[model samples]
Target: MKRWTHPQDFIALIVGVYALLSPLWTTTTSKATTTMVVLGALTAVLSVIELVRPDTLSIEGLTALMGVLFFISPWVMGFSDMRAMSWTAWAAGVITFVIGAADLRVTRSHRGTVATTL
Candidate 1:
C-alpha cells in the first residue's frame, strides 16, 4: 500500500474515487460524467507526479486550473439545480484546486527543503 504523504495526493485520491463513482450515483451521464472522470484521473496523475517530484510549477498550475474547471462545470453548464451531489462534486473540485495551489506555494517557499535540484 502506497501511503499518501502529501495533501495533493490525498485530494487527488479523493477526487479520483469520486470520479470513478459519480457516473453510477450522480444520475448524470454522457459529457458531464465523462468530463468529471477525465478531470478526476488527471488530478490523481498530477498528484502522484507532485508526490514523486514536487517541483514542477507547470503541473501544479495545470492541476489547479483543472480543479477550478471541475468546480464550476455544473454552474457554467447550467446544471446548478442538479442536487447535493453536484454541489459536493463542485466543492471537492474547489478543495482540490486549493490543495494544488497550496502545494505549489509551499514547494516554492521551501524549495531548499522540498524541491531537489536536478
Candidate 2:
C-alpha cells in the first residue's frame, strides 16, 4: 500500500495516455475517438494537479467519473460496432477506475493524521 500513495496518480496518467492513443492502434469511430481523447486528457491533467496538491481528492473522483464514462462510451457514443475499440474502452475504463479509486483511498487514509496536524 505504501507504493499506492499520491504518487500512485502516475497510474491514472499512464492509463490516460493509453486510452488517448488507443484509437490510433484500433479501429474506432469519430465519436469514440473524441470521447477517449477528451476523457483521457482530463484524467492526465487532473492527475498532474493532484500530484501538486495532495489535498485535492476531488480530482480523483473526477478521474473516476471519467473512467465510468469511458466504460459506457461505446454504447453512449454508438461505436459498439467496433469490437476491438469497445474492448479497449472497457479495459482502459476499468484500469482507470481502479487507479483513481486507489488514489482516493490513499488520500483519505492520510486525512486523519492531517486533521490532527491542523
Backbone clashes in each candidate structure, one number apiece? Answer: 0, 0
Question: Could you give me the TM-score of model 2 versus the true structure?
Answer: 0.87
Q: What lDDT does each candidate get?
A: 0.70, 0.80
Q: What is the lDDT of residue 37 in candidate 2?
A: 89
Candidate 2 local lDDT, 1-118, one digit each (tens): 2333465688788888888888898887789889888878887887777777767547778878778988998899998888998888888789888887886776676777678889
Per-residue CA lDDT of model 1 for 1-118, tens digit only, reads 1234666667776776676567777777476677677777777777777667655556667777867987887777666677755775687678878876886676566765544643
Candidate 2 least-lDDT 10 residues: 1-10
How many Å off is the CA of 7 in candidate 2? Answer: 3.8
> RMSD (Cα, Å) of candidate 1?
3.8
Reference-based TM-score of each model? 0.76, 0.87
